[model samples]
Target: MHIKVKFLAYFRDLFQSREKIIALPEGARLRQLLGSLCDSAERHKAVFGKEESLSPHIVIMKNGVPVQNSGGLDAALENGDVIAIFPFIGGG
Candidate 1:
């Protein structure tokens, strides 16, 4: 299956692009895609946490909607789904 993944803001720089299409086995979960995307230790730590789990500080959305209501990291992704990754931001 193929899904579109987008990395926004600082994540884009980390991934070295804003978006890309990734191929995964059918029934792939959000964590699979994340693990495949953040290959390096630096990228992995930035996206995933010290515990190797999706960082709570990072914002993840599925097809324009937040994934928290959809099972979060375990969310089952379907073909053609769009996953957007955004780093946490704070400004005064």
Candidate 2:
């Protein structure tokens, strides 16, 4: 299956772009896709935290609606799903 992914902030550094079309296996979840896209331990650790958990500050949305209600990274993503990921940011 093919899915569209959009990254924001530092994530773009890892994938080299803010958006792309990726190939994923059937029944892949958001977490799986992210790990595949940013698999390197160092890279994952840099974009995410510990490479094992979704950083508390990371934001995920599907079709512009937050999937936080989907219990976070566990959110199931189907083909053609549009995922937007954002890192925490602050301006003072």
Candidate 3:
């Protein structure tokens, strides 16, 4: 299954791109896809917290809706699903 992952802001620097086409196994959830994408421990922690929890400051959307509202990282992803990920940006 091929899914589209989009990186916003600093996340692009981490993934080395603004978007990528990720090939995931059948029945793969968001967590599995994320784990595969984060190449290092630091990068992984930045996206998914310790114990594989989604970071509070991180924003994740599946198909334009917040993932938490749609079953979180446990959400079932179909082929060609679009995932947008990035840390919440704040301005003062």
Which candidate has the highest lDDT of all?
Answer: 3
> How well does candidate 3 match the true structure in TM-score terms?
0.91
Instruction: Rank candidates, lDDT, best first.
Output: 3, 1, 2
Off by over 4 Å in 3: 90-92
lDDT of each: 0.89, 0.79, 0.89
User: Which model scores highest in TM-score?
Assistant: 3
Question: What TM-score does candidate 2 reach?
Answer: 0.80
* All models, RMSD in angstroms: 1.7, 2.3, 1.5
The TM-scores, one per candidate, come to 0.90, 0.80, 0.91
Which window of ten consecutive residues has the lowest lDDT sum in model 2? 42-51
lDDT of 1: 0.89
**How displaced is residue 46 in candidate 1, in Å?**
0.8
State the weakest 10-residue window (summed lDDT) of model 3: 41-50
lDDT by residue for model 2 (1-92), tens: 88898988877886689898989998988888878877677667654655467767777788898877776778888899998888767799
Candidate 2's C-alpha runs over 4 A off are 90-92
